[model samples]
Target: MHIMEGFLPSPWWQVWFLVSLPFIIIGLYQINKLVQEKREALPLLAVAGAFVFVLSSLKLPSFNGSCSHPTGTGLGAVLFGPCIAAVLGLIVLVFQAVFLAHGGITTLGANVFSMGIAGPAVAYLIYKVGTRAGANTYATVFVAAALADLATYVVTSVQLALAFPGTAGFLGAFSAFAAIFAVTQVPLAIIEGAVIMLVFKYIVQLKPEILTRLNLLSESTIKKLQEAAA
Candidate 1:
């Protein structure tokens, strides 16, 4: 969910900007390193950024000053780690804020923090844990993507609740925002998860070498996925 442009009042927006700055800085560094180390990944990185832009632009009216949509950060996180994904997300958000009017420049920091930093971080962690646990590759992808979408909304809710606690206080406000987001976000998460799973499968089938270079999958697992696709 994107908290609309300028919806957040004075200090809250500034706070979020400060909080999100470090991640963005680190993400930029990571991206430069990636570009230098693996020029072959440039095209795939573009695809990931486009995926985030397109999916997140599909906004549906939700709570006041906010909207719900699929956050496509998980695929990038799974493909290139969370820091690099954050850079991709930041670029997408900037474009959305400028031309698309989906989000606002004032609240860009908050949106990036939730969708880019928090969501991708959680997704990357989940993917790592799932793979380490010997879970099915596609299944893990689904879970990571789904949970990443949900995580974005959750962080958005937190940001909203913090900005406007009202009489119900922070916890109460968070519960209210989260409840509203869950109605739309849950379904979107499931659909995004399925879509990302399919995309990952395709990548596994067609570009297993890339996965091997990235250490995303073991040779044995890539072989199995390739065979399954065949």
Candidate 2:
């Protein structure tokens, strides 16, 4: 869900920009280094960025003034890590804000924080934990993607609540916003998870080497995928 242009107050949006600035800078640095070192990742990054751009652009009406849509950063988070996901997300958000005019420059920081940073960060952590626990590849991807989507909504709700606390206080407003979005967001996240899970499954089948290069698909995981393919 995007806050749209000029929806947020001046101080709040600037604060969010300040908060997200460090992460964006660091992500840019990491992405530059990665591209310079391994040119092979460039194509995958483009695909991932495109996924986020197209998927997130397809918004469904809900969440009061805002809208709900899939924040398609899960695959990138798992494959490229959260830092790079944030960078890709920045590109997507900025493009939408500038060209499509879906969201605004003032709220770019807030949107980036929720969809780009929070969601991908949680997804990456879940991927790490799930894989280390020996979970099935698709299952882990599913959970990671689902949780990442949920995390984005959760952060968005908090940002809204803080910005515009209604008759309900902060916590109450948060709950209210979450409940309102839960109707669509939860299901959307699940569908997104399943869809991305299938895509990742194919990555495992076709270009599993990419995962190995990212250090996400370990030798054992590759073996398991190969055996299953066999």
Candidate 3:
């Protein structure tokens, strides 16, 4: 969910902006490097951006200015990596803010941090662990996508609590925000996971070499996929 426009106080928003900027720069560099290396990956990158934009833009109603939606960063993280995911997520957020009126400029950094950096990072880690654990391809992708989406809301709740620690204090406010978001976000995340898994399955069937070229598909994963197909 976006923290909404003008919701964050001064300094807090500025702090987030400063913090997220470097990640975006790094993300840009990573993307450029990927492009130079694999020109064919351009279509996949575009699809990842579109996924983030479509999924994240579907806002659920909020009590306060904030609203919840799927971060959609995990798909990009799996297809590319966390750095590229962050860049894609940032672009989606900016587009949403300008045209959709969902998120605002004041809260862009906080939104990007939760949706772009934090969530995608978690997704990348989960993917690594899942593969190491020998989880099936679908299950691994699903877990990564779902957990990443949840992580985004968790970080968003924390950011909100930090910005406005009410009488109940930071932890209390954070819990409250998290609980509220869980109602809508959990289901959305599951859906997101399923969608990503299906998309990945289609990609695998169409062009398994793409993942191999990106260094994403390990030999073990390839063997598992072949076994599953067989």
Cα lDDT tens digits, model 3, 151-216, are: 998999999999888999999999999998888678777877887788788777677887887788
TM-score-superior candidate, 1 or 3:
1
Off by over 4 Å in 3: 36-44, 58-69, 226-230
Question: 1-230 in candidate 1: lDDT tens per residue?
Answer: 77898799999999999998898899888877878988866887898799778877776344443455678888788888888888898899998888788789999999989988999999999999999999988999999999998999999999999999999999999999999888867877887788788878888877778788888888998888788768
Candidate 1: count of backbone clashes, pairs at least 3 residues apart or interchain: 0
Best by lDDT: 1
Q: Candidate 1 at 168: error in angstroms?
A: 0.7
Q: Pick the candidate with the highest TM-score.
A: 1
lDDT of each: 0.86, 0.84, 0.83
TM-score of each: 0.90, 0.89, 0.86
- Model 2 weakest lDDT span, ten residues long: 59-68
Ranking, TM-score, top scorer first: 1, 2, 3
> On a 0 to 1 TM-score scale, where does candidate 3 land against the true structure?
0.86
Query: Which residue segments of model 2 deviate by more than 4 Å?
Result: 39-44, 58-68
Which of candidates 1 and 2 is the stronger one according to lDDT? 1
Candidate 2 per-residue C-alpha lDDT over 139-206 given as tens digits, one digit per residue, 9 for 90 to 100: 88899999899998899899989998888889999999889877767877887788788878788888
In terms of lDDT, the poorest run of 10 residues in model 3 is 60-69
lDDT of 1 at 98: 84
